[model samples]
Target: MAIVSEALTVEELYYNYPDGTAALRGLSFKLMPGESVALAGPNGSGKSTLLLHLNGLLRPSRGRIAVGGKPLDAAHQAFARRYVGLVFQNPEDQLFMPTVGEDVAFGPQNLGLAGEKLRERVRSVLDQVGLEPARFLERQSFNLSIGEKKRVALAGVLAMEPEVLVLDEPSAGLDPRSRRRLIRLLKDLPQTQLVATHDLDLALEICSRTLIVEQGRLVAEGPSEQILSDRVLLETHGLELPLCLMGRPDR
Candidate 1:
């Protein structure tokens, strides 16, 4: 089989839950290296399902997914993990270690990194997330604020140094300041990113391309400004224009 050069690709992806609920319906998209794309949709629109598949957390009943040119399957699970990192919508689900540094060190530790190298890895990612290693390393996860916890969670995934970052509702529970900081941080990172978010503003600010999903299928795919400006199309898929862009026809 020929290798796909794209950073990520999905072909006719279909998935159904054990309870008979269809989560994804023929979803297909490709992300080139260093490209950032937004996967926007309403709740239960398969955005999370798609992110899970990118990192091999969930398997499709039908169809295929490739990460960094490698096909994802049971045999390539570890390879997929190394190539793709997924951050959950909820920080609590991803942050389990008692201290902030411990959580960030988990992935590299699993990969056999230890001693000073592991500490440096953890510190670098924490700094990248805007959490200074000096202060946050020893802090307990349960004691951190929601915004801080979210950053800690992100640091964990960033520490893995994946080629692709797949985030599910990254801005879901953040304050305006925290959210803006996150946007800036993500923009500075050079990895290929697929963000599944309802924050149209974030999508507009970060993603070059946007894909809208509704009822387990893609409804629209185009440039961010073009897709978000289509009021009728957004409304049909349970999305609204960003507040700043509202009342502006030229947007």
Candidate 2:
């Protein structure tokens, strides 16, 4: 089958941290609409750095990033933000309002939605994340469990109705049950997902394609099954094959 073009495209991307540490070098990829992909790699492998560039949090030190065929620019930054909603690795970083509903409402409100429409959007997104609208809406953000907070953060992003969802280490630090819940929720969502994670199991379950990076450069790109099944290649880049794939009967 021929590959469809992309809803978001990154070409020849290069970026360096303020301390002069290069994070991404000549990275290029395209995310087709409704496609799920995992960006897997080790620490300092530039996963977070790449996510930052997707929504214009960090402009490229070199090369270009385009959303829906329009190059990223000052005027188009707002449009890009609306199109690509980034859910940070830490829920605290993304959710700041006193109440869960307020936090979820922040993004839509900023987009100038108000009154009934804003309430409907907030309630709808919270429900979508499996958080009961009435029960969670008035609750304080700090009182919720880590998993609940993560879902709330996602609800906040979903409220924006983004075409592309960028997630950074979404399953990190969750208990088994919470992790399972998150995986199920992720699988159910209809939006295109660009997930940055070290969880190969989750990646295998939810993503069709995998991009492996090491030390600021993309080392592997292919179908998730092929990339994740190659134990030697994964080990070379300081990664591991998913346990289920390690002792497969066919292998």
Candidate 3:
């Protein structure tokens, strides 16, 4: 087998809140370019904390985190932000601009792209996410539906053209059709994706690898099939195995 190059790497990462309550405890993992990996865990399992560290939003209290082979710190934070595009679990948190176009253009504009190039980037991303550029460009974010808002949020991150896309619960509270559409869009994106979600079926459908986190610690890491099929392990970690794979003699 060929070795994949690392897009994100965490080395013994540990993080704590203001009150000194640790949220992440010595967690370590590597994300390769063009790879889609799912992060599965219950609430307060450090999933969000780990995601924040990928883009330098929250520095590790101990150990180190590197994005695209560079250390995540003040010196490399700007570079890390450009390389890692994070789509928040709530679209409301990500969409703050008066207009959808402006929100999508925010990242690229900050990066110094202007004129026709910036417009092209914004339009391209919006279209890629299944939003009609002409229709959404002038629309206010607050007026859009939940699904549209999610797409716009994704477009904003896509406009940045980051090497890695870190998504936190991308499929939360959406209708079945919307969920499927989002999953399809994610599957089609040509970027490395680290999806932190409670949707095991989504993970099994879209991710090649899986990482199980529990109580601020990583308990298991392996191919999605093996990890998802391990009923005992899943139950112990407060997770459930996908039904289709629950009882198959061949598996």
The candidate that achieves the highest TM-score relative to the unseen native structure: 1
lDDT of 2 at 81: 93
- Expressed as tens digits, the lDDT of each residue in 41-84 for candidate 1 is 99999998888889889899899998877899888899998999
Q: How many pairs of residues collide in each model? A: 0, 0, 0
Per-model CA lDDT versus the true structure = 0.91, 0.90, 0.90
Error of 3 at 98 (Å): 0.7
In model 1, the clashing pairs are none
Residue 134 of model 2: what lDDT? 91
For residues 160-236, what per-residue lDDT tens digits would candidate 3 score against the true structure?
Answer: 88999999998887778778888898898889999999999999999999999998899999999889888888999
TM-score of 3: 0.92
Q: Compute each candidate's TM-score over C-alphas.
A: 0.94, 0.93, 0.92
